[model samples]
Target chain A: MNAIVSAPAARLVHVPLGERAYDILIGSGLIERAGHEIAARLKGRKAAIVTDENVAPLYLDALVASLEAAGIVSASLVLPAGEKTKSFEHLMTVCDAVLEARIERNDAVIALGGGVIGDLSGFAAGIVRRGLRFVQVPTSLLSQVDSSVGGKTGINTRHGKNLVGVFHQPDLVLADTDVLNTLSDREFRAGYAEVAKYGLIDKPDFFAWLEANWRQVFAGGVERAEAIATSCQAKSDVVVADERENGPRALLNLGHTFGHALEAATAYDSRRLVHGEGVAIGMVLAHEFSARLNLASPDDAKRVEAHLKTVGLPTRMDDIPGDLPPAEVLMDAIGQDKKVKGGKLTFILTHGIAQSFVADDVPSSEVLSFLKEKHPR
Target chain B: MNAIVSAPAARLVHVPLGERAYDILIGSGLIERAGHEIAARLKGRKAAIVTDENVAPLYLDALVASLEAAGIVSASLVLPAGEKTKSFEHLMTVCDAVLEARIERNDAVIALGGGVIGDLSGFAAGIVRRGLRFVQVPTSLLSQVDSSVGGKTGINTRHGKNLVGVFHQPDLVLADTDVLNTLSDREFRAGYAEVAKYGLIDKPDFFAWLEANWRQVFAGGVERAEAIATSCQAKSDVVVADERENGPRALLNLGHTFGHALEAATAYDSRRLVHGEGVAIGMVLAHEFSARLNLASPDDAKRVEAHLKTVGLPTRMDDIPGDLPPAEVLMDAIGQDKKVKGGKLTFILTHGIAQSFVADDVPSSEVLSFLKEKHPR
Candidate 1:
């Protein structure tokens, strides 16, 4: 037997019929608790922890130490950080590194950076042979709250963000909220938008609590940590029910439709207006569009706007900062969105502050009017 | 609303549960027939088609012509080929190309290539402004029988092949049998592995039928076409039931674990083999492993091996074109396969033909022994 000894205690939630059913570990310190868990699942082997240059500098050593402590050997695959790093070329780099390191399936993969690392590494994990097993150690706020929880993974193509990839869920997702302390406020806030989306879509109680506890989340406190972790429960369950965003689970796209357009329109080059900030504006626009379409009341739009503004997210045109691209440019780019059915536009419009719908067949004229009104050139 | 009213209606099989219901259209001439079907689904104002060079060269003009014939204002994005091309850089190319084409939210994206193009384009559609609609016109056998039918999309990274991507099912999948003519005999043969898998995993009767009819299927005939389309139905039904590889549906990985190992051992280089060829060999190995373990009867192993060989697929070390990779090299690569969970291999070993189990905690030594026997040094 290997030197490692731990409970084969991790639970695999059977999504049924079988390979898609993933496990969820409500454990503590797994990022550094490698061997214990690895031994239980992997039968005591080393792991190659794939992180970014940005993340490895901070935690790769600790993860390596954990694997060693478990009597397992370990390696590090640290790539340069940036959204651009989450590309097929970078995925190839990781695959090559894994090959160079001779990482075996007997070993595990610890994706130790943020979403990009998790995605790049996890993606490498997926196709390393048609797949591999990896854990998610989300360093970025966006990852911990969103990307880390879903088995959804992939890199970007020149055509778009995350154009190529798969639904390769992690064996374990280690979201050390403590890591958020190291994140820039903007990145941390970007993650919060997804956390808040949960409340806005299904859990009004969480929304109420979020409104009350807005300070803690923005401030990045223990309470926010609990919220983010527990928030995973809701998302995980939703994912279990609709892992492909096929049903009600699509409510998660609350502000994504309009927000992504705005982001794409802007070329998403300006860091000043990150995804969360765009969502903040997009949610407002969605509410405004809903009101305009008589699908929602102005009060609902105002409520969503207030919630975002209160969280210090931008709710208007001036909120878009940095060298911005034109609205027409973003619109043109957004035309490539996957959500478009045939040649028609689809929108996730809200009926109220917390109720959303993935409205198919929405006319472009109406959508353009929404865009023109919200961010007039 | 541009020209001819070609209502290429998609034949949708609802996996149920509201929104997750996707369409699977299996008919004669679907890939070439995409424009009208896609345009009809174009609940939007404009549409874009994402493809690769190999496909675009053969099909783009016709697709564009078909769309124009339907009076739809369409645009196209042609990417390069191989796993290498599904990168963020290429994704950007599509993004730029789409933007240049003046697409709108009311438009849709047609993934008019094989799996690579479908993945990149589909993912682009998925994330574009928080999601857009996309139609899949799968050209490769792998895509037609497998990938194109599922909403799963994404790109690769330095880490792996399809490590990054999303599970966004297509509004419709157009599987045109005519496209099979374009693939080299090797590629066509490679895709047949998956065709073989469906039968091997769940339908022994289908397996028997394959033994009877594969000649016609490969040589081109109504029965072959029926079987191919039926294979899509088999997978589509399974996907509708599971959507993700979470349940009994995971039975699909019958040979994938070992196949992925072999492929990874080769770094997915085409020089060694195509993805399907690796899978073909892996299935034989799995059957032999089952027989060796006394889990499956020798006759079952013989039957499985015989079928693969009958198709001219490599079933033994001698059959593997080129030198067999070193045993240790192969085994070590196997160790990195994502299928290995915890230190044990979770193989889809069968008790007999069509009776498989997701056996976890299987000793790696046994795995190495199986390979030693199947792909001896």
Candidate 2:
């Protein structure tokens, strides 16, 4: 499982969204093949590539050359890196640039970075001419496994994260696993948190597989591609079941509620706590809180925490370097999450691994007390 | 047909786009009954009303009072009036206001003005939280007959008008005819252009009826209601056939190719010429151009011009109140239209009245020569 190779056969995950359906191709060296793959599928020969400054320096040229080689004309916009780029100002800039390129309805806008670029560019694609064909060339593990497959494109407002956007699915997704090799150790671990989330949601067998083979995944082997494929497949099923998050899709928010609150508590400073780390802690908290409610055994929570810790992920809130606001302050952030309905506390609590369910109207007092107990003294 | 009355029974136009289908209710006193009508359909009790200053002074209070009477709590934002308001700046302000109002996914955002407000507010409603229930309470004649029905919501950018937007269908539309009484004569005449448009698009009988009943439609009687209903049904059928404007929908732009160029020439200044007036002139041009191409008889072009002129609409370029650009420049603006694909000219030419058809690959030189012939020397 840990054997390293030059390349592997590409794997495909089809998002079954009827007319909006698309394919996600995962393997090493897929980025070099992006232009040919896209040209084969789409009718238009024009594309606008949106990437961050960091990614532009690394992958933008190769992607452009590939496109030009395939007789596809391309223009590129390189934005500053990070989460703050998911904003209305940047959305305006991206939109203007795409329009400036004269990319029409059938032409494509390609997202070529991590979540920030994917979300913002997808949003711009969604609105420019009421929607241009979109393609995702996710350059980070987090995006490849998550944002790229889901068409939830948006920008954050002063009001909240992802508070403005549209559901504009991509025409195709190219997840080049080799790019994950360029991510820092911390970023890689953070992405693994979401990969683990899939198993925790409904696949105990996959969770056990990760526990045994996560190291091979980190080592950039066949297991890594398998893990990413499985995560995308899991998400695709949920999206097909409920594209708009009307029902069972809430399960995808398993640790997102607490994760987002923690992100807010830190002012979204990635140095203090990146999204995946917050989610790592939040997932453990969810399992532990469920145990306190007697819905799951304490041993299950411990097992989950132990596996995450072994992967070098921060599984406790105190793992965050900076001082956090009081538990009640974090609670306020939770109340502000878009997922909270009519001020009711909605959470995904687990009965055990692979047994998560949406727990709505959970009393605020109980959540506060649990957070208080879990807070650093 | 011109008999005056206190109120009239509401007329309904159902846009059947499957699950996104909605109803447009047209009548004399629908505004006074807005709250009851909305409450009957939507589940959410919270609404955010977006109206412009001109409308706020007149109908905002009545709309608010009606909503309140029906047990709906609401918040209102009054933007400045005019076409400039349909922009990214206003879009951000509206999105922020909707978020600040805490209007959730299930809540509603109601647009209570003309095309600018409806387009901008509908865009905000479409994007805030991926989508919110939308209601359009169009307060102008142009909106009631045309803009309010298609579910096309967007904002203008430096690139062009409606260059950015989404296809967010409204849950309901209330086009109260009594509001037309408040429009200035010019504004009313401008809106009548679109009513004439529906007839020119596909209904020869409707065009003939409007020609015979022009005085009564202007007098605000049964003919007015009948004309509005017929226009909406025409638009509804077109929208149902091509909700995204991919195919048969292009016929709806019969006059728009010339109309949009005229608007762009005036920099969208209402003091010079408004949208419907531009369409009136454009519709005439389309017919004449068709005659030049021998696709339609010259008599048809004369009839369209005669009917529009009788309704007090501008039916020619020189009717505009200012110095015009050269026909070449107007043709340049037409080239920049989003509908123009790959530099090929596309125009809605007619075989005759009620015989509009999309003509693609039209020769640009032919268009330029035709424009020169029509321009005032």
Per-candidate DockQ values are 0.14, 0.75
The candidate scoring highest on DockQ is 2
Q: What's the CA error at residue B235 for candidate 2, in Å?
A: 1.0
Q: After superposition, how far is residue B102 of candidate 1 from its true place, in Å?
A: 6.3
Per-prediction TM-score, chain A only?
Answer: 0.90, 0.97
Per-residue lDDT over A106-175 for candidate 1, one digit per residue giving the tens place of the 0 to 100 score: 4567788877788778877765544556777777777777777767777765556655566676776666
A1-377: candidate 2 lDDT, tens digit per residue: 22222345899999999999999999988888888889878888899999998899889989998888777899999999988999889999999999999998778999999999999999999999899999999988999998898799998877777889999999999999999988999999999999999999999999999999999999998899999999999999999999988889999888888898899889888889988898899899999999999999999999999999999999988889979999989888887678867667889999999999998889999999999999945
Measured against the true structure, the TM-scores of the candidates, in listed sequence, are 0.65, 0.97
Cα error, residue B18 of model 2, in Å, equals: 2.1
Window of ten residues with lowest summed lDDT in model 1 chain B: B8-17
Task: Give the docking tier of candidate 1.
Answer: incorrect
For residues B152-212, write the lDDT of model 1, one tens digit per residue. 6766655445555556767777777777887888888888888988888878888889999
* Per-residue lDDT of model 2, residues B79-165, tens digit only: 999999998899999999998888987789999999999999999999999999999999998999999999999987766788899
